[model samples]
Target: MSFLGLAHCSLPPQAESLRQEVREFLAGALAGRGAAARAQSWDGFDPEFSRSIGARGWIGMTWPRRYGGAERSALERYVVIEEMLAAGAPVSAHWFGDRQTGPLLLRYGTEAQRVSILPAIARGELFFCIGMSEPDAGSDVAAIRSRARRVPGGWELSGAKVWTTNAHRAHSMLGLFRTAPEAAERHAGLSQFLVDMRSPGVSVRPITDMAGREHFNEVRLDQVFVPDSALVGTEGDGWAQVMAELAYERSGPERYLSGVQLLLELVRAAGPAAGERARVAVGRAVASMVTLRQMSLAIAGMLEAGANPAQEAAIVKDLGTAFEQSLPEVVHELLGVEPDRAADTDLGRVHAVLLELAPCFSLRGGTREVLRGIIARGLGLR
Candidate 1:
């Protein structure tokens, strides 16, 4: 088996120009935002901020114009996302819709679904949450026990989903349910649906994190009925469709930029009088970030070329999340500062928040073990 290599990819001049526009917009929008708030990273939810982003035509930039996209290049979209993440903007409101759901719909949804959903998502009016993990199954998506039974008009779903981010606030959920009995193949008999959050018998319970935030949720569905039109792609093909979606989830700059607020704080705390060791540690962290960005950009290029770089995306997410998870510890060691959320200094507060949030960096998109397994299988080393 041949090993995969991430080719160097450069952003176009247009993409850089778009970057400047995003920067200018964020400068005014994110003014007065403290480091503690910024430390929330993409987990920060602000619907108004998201709507403003939509008005700027920054969301769903790569989809066709008919679906409220600008029909811009993927690289342009990448630039916008990079800037948003780097600025530590509150983007969770539209993050799932713009990052994966819109693209998933464009690929697998019916024309009606696209017409009804994509425009709202592009306008940042409709928010979505993913329902894949179960109480028992986390990163092992195939082991999910959520079930959907055939009904007169559509399907009746009855199951529970855990760690569903923003489910309480989302208008809809892209849920994966088992439609048939378990077969010899573990991934068979699954289907995807766009379930309305307001449907009868659907309940959401927020899961507070170590940081005392409530972005994560546990969703329960008791025979929640969904119309036939809500079915995404062919029945029983959810495994393949979900795999494609994971490529989008794992290939973005969010994987690496989660702890950036802490990094910025470290730089502020370590002034020009910083010692050589501090400089070296900061330099190493920056170098890792740059390399991961290059790899992520390569995945975007492959995506633009109509290729599924699932393995490449897995590699980037694995490495990128590792970098993010390590940053808080590195900063603590370098600055010799104890993490205290109530501290008066920006660095202390940022560091404290990141210490709480960093543990989830690898657990969210895909666990470290799961990502490494993907990379190993891709390299034929398994």
Candidate 2:
């Protein structure tokens, strides 16, 4: 039950050098992009942009060279991701694959599966979505009712998943399903599989958010048949595997950088002669950003050292999302400006987009209540 300390973890010189290289690349790549468009943050999707990133060897920076990765340190990957996020690069096309799916395969997939899928993912030619949350079960992943029954040569998957990000555009999904009847143990029967999105019975219905965007989807699987090789790791090991996967999902720069575009606008809107309250709000937000970045970096260091920092990741996500969700309110209060999506100014447009999208920051990786429960259990207070 050891916890991560608040001490800062410094990135290596190579990582810093790579940071500048990423910045230069992003400058040319993201030029002429408006603040409103950039406000999408990691949710922006562009296949061409993702392919370009792959061409630069930035997509799978930490994976082995045999798998089309640069075999760089996790901290170097961190620098590249943070720079892309800050510049609002449209990375959603390869986001899930680079962030979790590729790593999951490296850790749990068969050698053949790795050889076949990892290289395409590293090349940014294949995209993936996570299929965990269902209509009945959102944050409570163990309660998923999707069933995968074994047939002669494959498994038949049936059920529906809600709030699935990128399912409409992704080529595949790393889905969780029930392989056995529920036992006294709540997590015993769950299993994971790699299901191709193009499978005959799979269908995706987009779910529009308050921002009028169709990033989330409801995916229905009606007896979708996946070959036996699609199974990830051993059966009944999905609980542990998915828990590890969540550590990757929750500890990234996207947790804290979601509101950065609006934050930059806030600073611009508040000139040198601003009131004390406005200055104080901006300063407080900056402080939280720096602290969260330090915590996330420490978790990256732990991951590099082969440690599972799930509890620490939960803590960072909870605080980071709270920071993100609060920016719009703070800006509205301090600047006395209402959000205007159709406004011509960058401040109005960015603020409008972020204000509409802020409520989802806490809901994406894991809910706030779920995150706190994880923290409580880790602290032996539950």
Candidate 3:
């Protein structure tokens, strides 16, 4: 029952229409003055770009209309995400909120929490980061040691989160902290809290990725106070809640397109000499990407049907990350460019950045090994 068995859902015509709309919007993005510049749009952050996405009613497109969303099918939002990643628009500003946290909140958050958070997220006025992986727990989310003791009106949180993407700029973090000792129940005592990054006891320091981007951060919480209502779902549903969240995280187009721009660049640069090898490589890559899209959309359709696509999502992530991570080497071989997209003013710079950032593809949502274990368990192999 992993991925809620979304290995089976279908797409409708409106998905293509959404893709066209996104295509047109991105085309006009460069025509305007002071157009936002970005090195890598997915990881790149631009408040204005995020707001524009919101203005189009594209952000949270699958959510209910009462919260400023279009109430569209999840398949439509899938198209929007596909186009956004292909265009490399600066979506990191609202990435987590639009991609995962909003959906997670809609499912598990209290009504008050939904009303307060969903609209702002839809408005693209706020940003969110994950506070799941700790220094010791990295991929072992069940091993998270960030403890939150019950206080008068709320919880007192004291713990550290590492590799929190965009924590320096996020308005809040969907933080995972322990409410009871692991000695009681490994997963029982866990809880999720909406921690204000600007709170008095919260400290955030940026971590620079190899691409010279300050996207990741180390977040320290020292007795930060979060109200009871800030808690998402029940007191001890963090593990289940987060498992659902990762499905949203890994099944998106972002997983497949992390290296797509470079792939597109390679295709263009291939020029008159796209030869059999280059043609085969690009064609294979595109086919894999398309299949990934179809799989992801199927999962989205399942979500629309109120099913959790965790297993479907795990397969998509493992495959998509491989496609994205392989683009650098594939493009380099096809284009005969030097391995150095890290340097500005060179065609290789983008490819180089993709190479440097490739290792993180599997690490972000969940480790590859963790995802495979879930898959194996789903297949009754474990």
How high is the CA lDDT of each candidate model?
0.90, 0.90, 0.82
Candidates by TM-score, descending order: 1, 2, 3
lDDT of 2 by residue, 1-382 (tens): 6674434689999999999999999999999998888888677889999899898899887999998889999999999999998898888999999999999999999999989998899898999999999988988888899999999998999999999999999999999999998789989989999999999999999999877889999999999999999999989989888988888999898999999998898888777887899889989998999999999999899888888888899999999999998999898887676678888789889888988898888988889999999999998988
**Candidate order (lDDT):** 2, 1, 3
- Number of clashing residue pairs, candidate 3: 7
> Best candidate per lDDT, number?
2
1 or 3: which has the higher lDDT? 1
lDDT (tens digit, per residue) of candidate 3 on 199-296: 99999988887667787899999999988888899898898898888888877777777887777767766766778998899899889987887777
* Model 1, runs deviating above 4 Å: none
**Candidate 3: 10-residue stretch with minimal lDDT:** 30-39
The Cα RMSD in angstroms, rounded to one decimal, for candidate 1 relative to the true structure is 1.1
The residue pairs in collision within model 2 are none
List the lowest-lDDT window of 10 residues for candidate 1. Answer: 1-10
- Clashes (backbone N, CA, C under 3 Å), per candidate, total 0, 0, 7
